[model samples]
Each structure stands twice: as C-alpha cells, then as structure tokens.
Target: MAVVVGFIPTPVGFAALEAAQREAERRGGPLIIVNVVRDGMQGDPRHADQGQLERAQDMVRRASVRIAVRQEHTDDDISDVLLQVVEEEKAELLVLGIRRERDMASHLLGVTVQKLLTSSPSDVLVV
Candidate 1:
C-alpha cells in the first residue's frame, strides 16, 4: 500500500513531510501527499478553490519526491478528514507534524493531535 503523508500549512506539517520523505526514500515506496481543507463559513469559503489544489500539488512537486498530491475539501473537521483519508487510502503509514508550543504538555492537552492519536487505526509518525 502507498504511504499517505497528511500535510497542513504549518511548520510542523512541513517537518512531518520531511520525515515522510526520508522514510519513503528508505523504503522505496510511493508517497501520497494529502491536504485536508475545510470548506464553509466557519472554515473558509475558498477552501475548495482550485487554486488550493494547485498549491498543494506545487508543494508536493517542490518536495522533490515521487508523490501523488491530493487536496480533499470537506465540511468535516480537519482531524476527521485526515482519518478519513487514512482509511480511504488504506495507507501503510501516516506522517504528521506536531506544532511547537510554549508548553508541550499543555498543547497535548488540547483536542487536535490527541483526538487523532486516539482515533487513528494505523501507525502514526509525529515529527
């Protein structure tokens, strides 16, 4: 199965991509880059815009790794979208970047990452 690396527009996300690239290189497997964008008012009306998909493809191209980039527009929360992508791809691995915070413990106490970790059915590599 392909390795699906979920990308977000964050420093941690980029770092996770780097980690995924390294792992892909070592394993000699194809990588699929996915960016889950929420579309709507509470999220962003332009989340489904073609420009966003182009940008995601550009980012994947710039990564210089053989990858198939996909932009998923959904009304669901970002974390939920990510898990959905994982299930859809039946991915061999999932890579994510952990954002830097003033207090790591406090940040982990929040919802996003913790929720994903708790709900994920596959191996997750947090960078």
Candidate 2:
C-alpha cells in the first residue's frame, strides 16, 4: 500500500510531507503527494505554485523512496479530492497539515482535516 499526503505551500504542509516520507520509508511503500488547487482560485494561498511543487518533489526524491506527485485543479471539496486520491492509491495512511492558532490553548482542526479524519477510509496523521 502507498502512503498519501496532502501538500500545500506552507510550512505545516512541508512538515506533513516529511512525516509522510518517513512513514513511506518505514512501510517500504511508495509515497503519493497530492496538491489540490481549487478551481478559479489562483490567489488562494492554500494552493501550491509550480516552484513549490518542484521543491516538494525534490525533497521526496532526496529521500530515496518511490514518489508520485499529483497536482490537480478541482472545484470539488478539498477533503473529497484527497479522499479520492487515497482510495485510488490504495493508501495505508493519509497525512495532512493543520494550522494552529498560537493564542489558543487547543488547536482547532480545519474543515478539510475534520472531514478527512472522519471520512477517510485509511488511517490519518495530522502535522
């Protein structure tokens, strides 16, 4: 089975990528990095640019594990797209990055993370 990770351009997203790579190496499986760009949202910070995608790919390559990067533009819900990839890849684990408010005592999960946590067919890890 593969290890799937949701990647954006943020630090948290890179963290998730690193975690997923380690997991993939541990499991001796391939890594699938899914970067989703919401359709008609060119200005969205959540979407990764070409440079960012290349950087992520390079990072994974240096890890010496098999990698497949899927950068897609979609109008569907982010969680749904990620779940679909996980299903298609037959992923054993799904990794995601979540933002945390420094002022809050507890970190609140994002909409996508919440949805995936409950709906994903595989196990999930949030960084």
RMSD of each: 3.3, 1.9
Off by over 4 Å in 1: 41-66
| Whole-structure CA lDDT of model 2 | 0.87
Report how far residue 44 has shifted in candidate 1, in Å: 6.6
> Candidate 1 lDDT, tens digit per residue, 1-127?
5567777655666677778877766666467877777765445532434565465566556544478777877776777878887788676678877667756776566686787778877778877
lDDT, residue 80, model 1 = 87
Best by TM-score: 2
Residue-level lDDT tens digits of model 2 in 1-127: 6899999889889999999999999988699999999998879998888899999999888765689998977998988999999999899999987765452223334566678989999999878
Predicted structure 1, TM vs. truth: 0.74
Structure candidate 1, residue pairs in collision: none
